[model samples]
Target chain A: MNIKNSNIIVLVSSILLVVGFIISIVNTMVLVSPTEHIEGSWKEISWEYEKTESGNTNKKISDAIKTEICKELIIHEAEVWNFLAGGNLELTSNTNNETLSWTMKGRGNILELSHKTNKIEHYNIQILNNDKMVLYFSTDIQAKGIVKMTFEKIKEDSYAQKI
Target chain B: MLRKFSNSRTLKDNIQLGALSAFSAGMVNVTSLIIFFAFTSNVTGHYAILAEEISKGNWYQASVVFAWIFMFFIGNFISNIIIINFNHKNAYAAHSAPLIIEIICLLAVGYYGHFYYRETLSETEIMVGTMLFAMGIQNGLTASISNFSVKTTHLTGLTTDVGILTAMFTKKKYRQNKQLRSKFNVLLAIAAAYLAGGIVAGVIYYEAKFLVFFAVSAVIGFIILYEYYKLKVTKYIRIKRTIKLRKGILETT
Candidate 1:
């Protein structure tokens, strides 16, 4: 090998490596920024239902204490959601809001919020909710993989106001 | 006349043949990648991609990938049959058959791709399959001549070999020094040239896709003519000198 020629190859190789690394970094940063920096929190509710196998009665039935259970479930859910919201919610001032929809792919997320005739799009919102308080959140995932999530709704706070 | 026909001729013949084959491989790789978004030169990367796609349940993309693979196999099969029947060891005649096949395929691409079947089949499928076959034939025919040492199709193995050889050169334990250096240099040249060719191919294909194949055909033609001329001239000069010496001997006698 000619030392000079080999040196040139080495130089080219280093340049290619650096360029590749930089591209990878930029791509990652661009992809991660919106998803990581979304300025919203999810207010959600959780309900747990179970099946029981009994010898005498192998049928579905809501427990006799179902109302209390439901109330506790709702209250627990509200507290958790309120804790998650960190005081960033309005309960008294009701205003018409539109439902937003979005999809997350690879490193990036695309969000679409539709209200009236005008729809606004957000980048990288981890969670969203409609007026009915249904929560929609996204997580970073592979080309295709199981994305883990938790959803719930919080109790109303009288003093809370929308920012 | 007889003395001129010796083993050294074999070395020169193989080098010229190998370089041409390598160039053909490069052209095939470039053209295939540009047209099909697939690589026919080496199936290793393709296989990896296929596996990943399959795992992700990407059946459509996997099918497209396999189309290229099948085309490459077709190219290899066709080239092998042609070479086996005609005895492609002869320099000029050996390259001509494959060159004709490659040109015919390109014309087919222009015809089928442009007007006749453009709407019939997906562009991606046609381009991938056809380019695969082109690279296959190009690789198969030239690979036959080069004893497969010089591959133009891809540089992964070449890069690996170069790395190994370079590392070996640094170690002080090698017994065969001079021979090692020559072999290493040859590997280095093959790899470096392959990368350079890839970069050039990328640039050229952006401007003119068909020119890539035409340029390759020209290069291979040039190599064949070069070897033919060099061998004929050397033989002719040797014969003339031999005749002159015989005449001188007769005069002296």
Candidate 2:
């Protein structure tokens, strides 16, 4: 083998090892971004008004209100959002099946989804982890209010829990 | 823009190189941001994101960011390697090789996004990584060949340099310094070109989509061909002068 080639190979390998080692060590210490945790299958848990002129309420949102809020949005009340690798998000609901593309903006704090119809929507990622995510989006569909949407990561293909 | 190599390159050469390369760099960063929600020209943000991922114990995300940064590193490594190894063999080839590779990378991303992009997370990661690598190669070649006097891919350093020079120009003595003025001009050209490129790209991206990549590649391709044409014309002129000198000497004899 050529000395120059071997030397270069060794250098490259050393750098790669160093990078991998640092990341693995940091992984144990653990601080993941929203983009990574946003992936995989998430079942919609709820849709509620996060902010209102009256006051915050823990009461359940009516089915009529849910439908109204989802009217302008592509996703329905009880869809299973399967966020796969490479920005493809497959949304499956009882009456609808939709495919959309997603990207993280504002340093992974915002999730931007682009539909096949060229409609774009942005949601603020409130909280994201291994199994749960909370998204907040403002809707002017009815009046003006902040809508909070919750999702739980599904372990299997089953959607036992949905909105 | 690419006809000369280290030490011999003039301020004019650096300015031309800086402006054109920075323009492409701007287009690339904006396009990547639009398509992938990423800034490909610089690694500072990626480093932060990598740390954020690692700190969260998200091995998958951490690995992805790490790999992205590594691609950038590898691009720089490969670019410099080509320059060092081939500079003696042929300076133009050495310098131009990295750019050709960059063009190929840009075109690949463009073609893939245009025709086959299903918009998957993995695709975004890979495309952004490839772009970072391409930008890395560009930054490396420009810096190396220009003897580090010109770097056009990122603005942190350029901005800092511009700020310092602007402050220095406050002094009439420094304002009269030719070298300082030339350096300032080059830096300004890079900054302006980068901004203009980003604006043009952002506007056209809405209309062109992935075709913007093809346009960026065309700009880069023009640089190479322009230099090649200049080299040929210079060679022809030199050959003619040598022939004329020989004929004059024979007539005198």
lDDT of 1 by residue, B1-253 (tens): 0111123334444444545556556666666555444465687887786687568644444555555565676687788677667653554464556657766666566455445532211444565566667767776765565555545565777778777878887777653586566556556555555565566667777687556655655665665566567668988999999999999999999
> Relative to the unseen true structure, what is the C-alpha lDDT of residue A76 in candidate 1, on a scale of 0 to 100?
15
Candidate 1 per-residue lDDT, tens place, A49-163, comes to: 2222223232222334333432322121122222111212221213322233332221122233322334432222233332222222221211111122234332244214533
TM-score for all models, in order of appearance: 0.51, 0.78
Alpha carbon deviation, residue A123, candidate 2 (Å):
3.1
Per-prediction interface RMSD in Å: 14.5, 5.1
Best by TM-score: 2
Error of 1 at A40 (Å): 34
Per-residue alpha-carbon lDDT of candidate 2 for residues B1-253, written as tens digits (9 for 90 to 100): 6767888999989998889999999999998887777789888888898788568765656676777777787888899999989888877888889999999999999999999986555577778888989999999989988989888886999899999999999999999999999999999999999999999999989999999999899988887888888889999999999999999999999
Error of 1 at A109 (Å): 20
Model 2: fraction of native contacts: 0.10
lDDT of 2 by residue, A19-82 (tens): 6856644653365546667778988898878886545465356778788988788665546898
